[model samples]
Target: MTAKFHAFLQNGTWELVPYDASMNVVGSKWVFKIKRHLDGSIDRYKARLVSQGFTQVPGVDFTKTFSPVVKPATVCTILALVVSCGWDIWQLDVHNTFLNGFIAETIFVHQPKGFEDNNYLHHCKPSLFIYSREKITIYVHVYVDDILITGSSSAHVSHLISNLSQTFDLKDLGPLHYFLGIEFHRDAFELILSQRKYILDHLLKINLAAAKPVSSSMATSFQLSRFTREPLSDSTQYRSIVGALQYVTLARPDVAFAVNKVCQFLQSPTDEHWGAVKRNLRYLKGTIDSGLIFSAHSSDTLIAYFDADWASFPNDRRSTGGYGIFLGSHLTLWRAKKQPTIAWSSIEDEFRALANTTTELL
Candidate 1:
């Protein structure tokens, strides 16, 4: 706590002031977290003092809320391009990210509980920043404080790092081994991206670490319906695990269909839906190392494959359709979702899937 307060003082985060009853003072609290490495080992402990923004009036204390976030597809597409082009991939982290932002609001917050220096202070995201020029392009993708950088030339990329270091307290993490929960492993021929540790961590969270692994994400004979089985007495865990599984699909497209099936019942999930969720996790347990592979020698030819399950949903007779898009030999994008409307025949369902795929291709 002392160290955190000292760092806040060093950053000129806030000034101590006498309490005024007329002022709309906000409360502050310290948040502590453990920073872990890709191997699930502790790296360091972190502390941050944040304002309880929930206490303020929206239009008065704050007018608008905006955070710049890069799309998952954008990151995957660029990564594939970089690997295919034989470019360098680097990672960076900006310290005290919240202290660097420019704020126009006049706000006051109570001093932290334990280390009150008789003062009050006021406070604060694009996830991606890119620089591109003719024959030279540098991509600086920021996920909060952590950044993933890649470009055409190693020299220019290092120059950018030097410049960034001079401007902000930054750490160049050298090679993009990990970024935004995805781990990158590079070799002579291909770049393998996976979430092995991420999967295990979540599996342990739900106490499925020792469960038997399954080869398939879903049961081939299982049917999904809103009214099947008894409704879960509590759906919080079901919803939470399923949501995490949805993110897992970012790298494991094979489970996309299974995840989508369980997600349909999120509003009121039943025991059967919960069981489906566990099955997906078990599948992940067996294939924790599975991920997208980007080959260095692959072509840039874009190809797509789409398919549909005709009248798969017994309740509504709606078909589920999905598509996988490959950039060269790398699978960069894919989605598994139920069709918007019912189709009478399998051929019509397939055509609808093709139309969706074509739209995504463009």
Candidate 2:
């Protein structure tokens, strides 16, 4: 706690002021975490002091507090592009990035525990800074503090690291071995991306690691209905498994359609739904060894395919549409979703699915 307070003070995070009752005081808390590498080695212990933003009034305290995140598809596309050329990947962490934002509202947060402070509130700017030169473009994607640096040239990457090091308190973690829970393993030719640890942890979470394996994500003879007489005692458990399964679809595109089917029942799931979830888990059990491998030999060609099952939803008569985008020979992106508008015929549903795929492709 002393170290955290000292660091905050060193970063000029906030100034200590006299207690003022007129200003609303927001609460602050210290968050402690242990950082680890992709190989399960301890990197460092982290301490962060954050304000209880829930205590702040929306318009008065801050007009907006929003941050953009890198989309999973964008990550996949970038990875495919990088691996297609077998280029190097790197990661950088900006220390105290949350404090980098420009605050517009006057909000006060109570001093952190074991620290002397009066109040707190701050807004942030883009915080994501980028620079590029002719034939040397370096891009940084900042989802809050975690930054990913990648580009075409090795020299450009190194230069960007030097520039970033001079500007902010940054850690140059060499090579992007891991980012956003996805692990990268590179060889002479291709980069293999996997969520093995995530899958094992997920299996352990629901106590299904030792369960019997199945070849298919969904039961061949089973059909799910909206009606449920015997709902699971804990609906959260169903939601939890379904949510985790969604992430599993990241590397295993084979399960995308199956997982999307389960996601639609998040609000009210029953034992029947849980049974289907278990079936999906069992499918994962059999296919835990599979992950996305982008080979350098494959051409960086884009191909998208779309199809639909006209008026398939038993509850709403809405058609189910599916699309897959392939980067080279690798399936980089895919989705299985219910259509928003009810289609009158299969031709209309096909056209709708085509339009959706076109939007994604464009």
Candidate 3:
């Protein structure tokens, strides 16, 4: 670890100095992990020095923090495009991506322990990549230390990694297989996306592996209303249900509407709501193998569908609006939301729903 820090310093990755007249330095720590192969063999020892980014203030430490990731729909569309056009699909990963992103704010960080220069113990300067190259169309999807770097060419991707590795101690993971719990499988004909392992693990964790599955997410008789005969005594169960359902939506858009409906009652749930939540879980049991499968046969054309249930809630009289966007045969994006304003007519409600969907589409 000391040797790695010395290499980082020699490469001009960061310069340690006294805290200057700039933003406060966030604290940092070393994280160590052991990499293991699928066969359970020891792969390598990994070490990371990371900033405590949670301490960063929203506007002060960072503004416009929204970094667009390749959405599920986008992923499907890209895969479909690869299939249709027969474009070679390759996945590349970056090592220590956050270290490459240049900080716009004059943020400082504490000198890493044990490797701190005695003469420069007070502060450390930022050496992020974004700070140095403003014009490059370099976008990175970061999940802590792991990163997925997508580019138009393998050479471009290689160049970016080469440049980055020059500055930081980096290990290249050739192609992406598992990212953010989603598993990827690629072949000459198709690129498959699934979370079968994740789903099974989740079900086992919630003690629902043996539960009976249902045909649909909710029953036709099920109606969620704001008014309830009795309030739920345990709120933790309600939150747990919501969290589980949220993860279920990764591959199961069918449950999205039902989950969204139940989520609306999170603040004040009732016995009826709890029953509905259980019903959704039971539905998951039957459809455990169900997930979004993005085939390479999909097209590039984009189409969207929108619908609404006006005044569906008896308590609030709020309408529920839902929209789904498709690229070719693959569904890329869908959203279920409640309308902000009450409408007197179905036409008015539908029109408002269209407006909302348009905003999202734009």
Candidate 4:
């Protein structure tokens, strides 16, 4: 807690101010989190001073909200390039990231409970920035404070890190073994990206870790419908699990279709929908180690394959379709989603999926 408070001081996150009865005072609290490694081991314990931004009056206190996030496809593409080129990849983490943002809004907040400085005061503020070198080329992908850096030259990469550390509080986490919940396992010929630990953690969280593994993500006979069975008494757990499964699709495209099917009924989930979700989980249990493998011998050619299921959803006549885009031999992008509008024929649905894939490729 003291370290977090000191970060606020060093970053000039807020200045001490006198308490005023008329000021819109936002409550502040300490958020504690245990940082863990990819193997589920404790990396460190972290605490951050956070403001209860929820209590603020929206229009008055904040006019716009923006989140600068790197696209997943972009990250995958870069990683694939790095693996194929046999480049050096490194992960970096910024300390006290949120404290570095400069907020223009005049905000008031109560002091942190234990580390209250001068009674009551309020302040607040909150990277997608990249740096590159000359002909050797370096790529830096930033998602908030977490960074993934790679370059063709090892010495150049080290020099870049040294330069970055001088300006920012940086943690050079060696080679990019893990970042953003995905684990990268690399050998001489290939790099395998997997979320085995994430999958196991989710299974344990939902108490399905002991369930028998299944061969398929979704059973052929498992057709879910909102009215097929009684609605869940409380839909919170159903929504929460389905939402969590969405993240799994990041590394597990094999379950993307199954997850997309279950996600359709988030609003009014039934026992049948929950059963399908459990089946997907069981399938993931069996294939927890599966992931996208980027091999070094990949070609530069881009290939795309798309297919459609005409009017597959019983609830809606909309067609279900998906596309897989491969660069050389490695799959770079894939998506399983329902069409926005119902197609008149199978060919029309197929064409829709093809058009979508072509758009993505372009």
Clashing residue pairs in all predictions, respectively, total 2, 5, 8, 2
- Please list the residue runs of candidate 4 whose C-alpha ends up more than 4 Å from where it truly belongs after superposition: 17-25, 56-60, 99-107, 119-134
Q: Note each model's CA RMSD in angstroms.
A: 3.6, 3.4, 5.3, 2.7
Q: Write the per-residue lDDT of candidate 3 for residues 1-362, one digit (tens) a residue.
A: 76657566665776556676665678889899876653346777767888888888887778865543445555555455555555543334444444455557666788787777777666675111222244333335444455565544556667877887776556676676766566677776666666666666656766878877778878776688778669988788788768877766766788889998899889889988877887787777777656666666766777889999889877778898999877787777888888887889899999998988787677
* lDDT tens digits by residue: candidate 4, 229-348: 898899999998898899888888898899999999989898888899999999999999999899999887889999999999887889999999888888888999999999999999
Q: Which pairs of residues collide in model 1?
A: 16-119, 127-142
Q: State every prediction's TM-score relative to the real structure.
A: 0.84, 0.87, 0.75, 0.89
lDDT of 1 by residue, 5-70 (tens): 765676687776666667788888889989888878897788777888899999988888776667
Model 2 weakest lDDT span, ten residues long: 118-127
C-alpha lDDT of all candidate models, in order: 0.84, 0.78, 0.69, 0.84
Local error of candidate 2 at 223, Å?
A: 2.9
Tens-digit lDDT track of model 2 for 1-362: 67556656676776655556577788888898988876778988888878887887777777777656766777777778777766787888876655455666666677666654323323120433446667765567777678887888888788878987886778887888877777788888888887877787788888899999998988655556778558777798888778888888878788887787788788888787888888888887788777888888777778999999898767888888999998888777899999998999999999999999999988
Query: Where in model 1 is the C-alpha error above 4 Å?
Result: 1-28, 50-65, 99-125, 316-318, 339-352
Q: List the residue pairs that clash in candidate 3.
A: 25-108, 73-332, 100-129, 101-128, 102-128, 102-129, 102-130, 213-286
Q: Which of candidates 3 and 4 is the stronger one according to TM-score?
A: 4
